[model samples]
Target: MTPEERSLRARLAAHVSWAATPDPASRTAKARAAADSKFEREAREMHPDASDEHIARVAKHLRSAHFSRMALKAAARRRNSATPKAA
Candidate 1:
């Protein structure tokens, strides 16, 4: 590529990379919301006869598990990001 074109491409890549890094608070909140909805749906399906207190406890447990899974996935990405790529 021409020097000017290469420079422009580099700048664009940097900008895109910076823009794509999610806000941690927003990401966590979104994950939690998704987990909450998922828990509600599954609880409703599997425990139609469950009481309010039991449902609350089950929902909390399920959401926490989902959040923890998300966290572990994020950690794995961070851990693997530094590895060298295959040629």
Candidate 2:
């Protein structure tokens, strides 16, 4: 995997159980907070010469992954609900 993809996966892995979260709004808030925290931590760990672009890239990847996970969970819930229970 590319460096960007690996970084994104690491960020996503840091925050688990996100998909199991029931409320969309709550899940979004959680994701945002986690992303922001991770970004700041990463920035702090980077060399002083590092640029904002790197931090932004990480944040973007995290947010995108979070939403993707949330969407998948919501779809799964919908599908399960739609399926009739066996007698």
List residue ranges in candidate 2 displaced over 4 A: 1-35, 39-50
User: Would you list the clashing residue pairs of candidate 2?
Assistant: none
RMSD of 1: 7.6
TM-scores of all candidate predictions against the true structure: 0.54, 0.46
Compared with the true structure, what per-residue lDDT tens digits does model 1 show for residues 1-87?
999999999999988876886775674788778767889777767788999778878888877887899999999998899788899
Please write out the lDDT profile of model 2 over residues 1-87, one tens digit for every residue.
Answer: 999999999888756555566777875888778768885666546535667777667656766777899999999999999999999
List lDDT for all candidates, in order: 0.83, 0.75
Q: Poorest 10 consecutive residues of model 2 by lDDT? A: 39-48
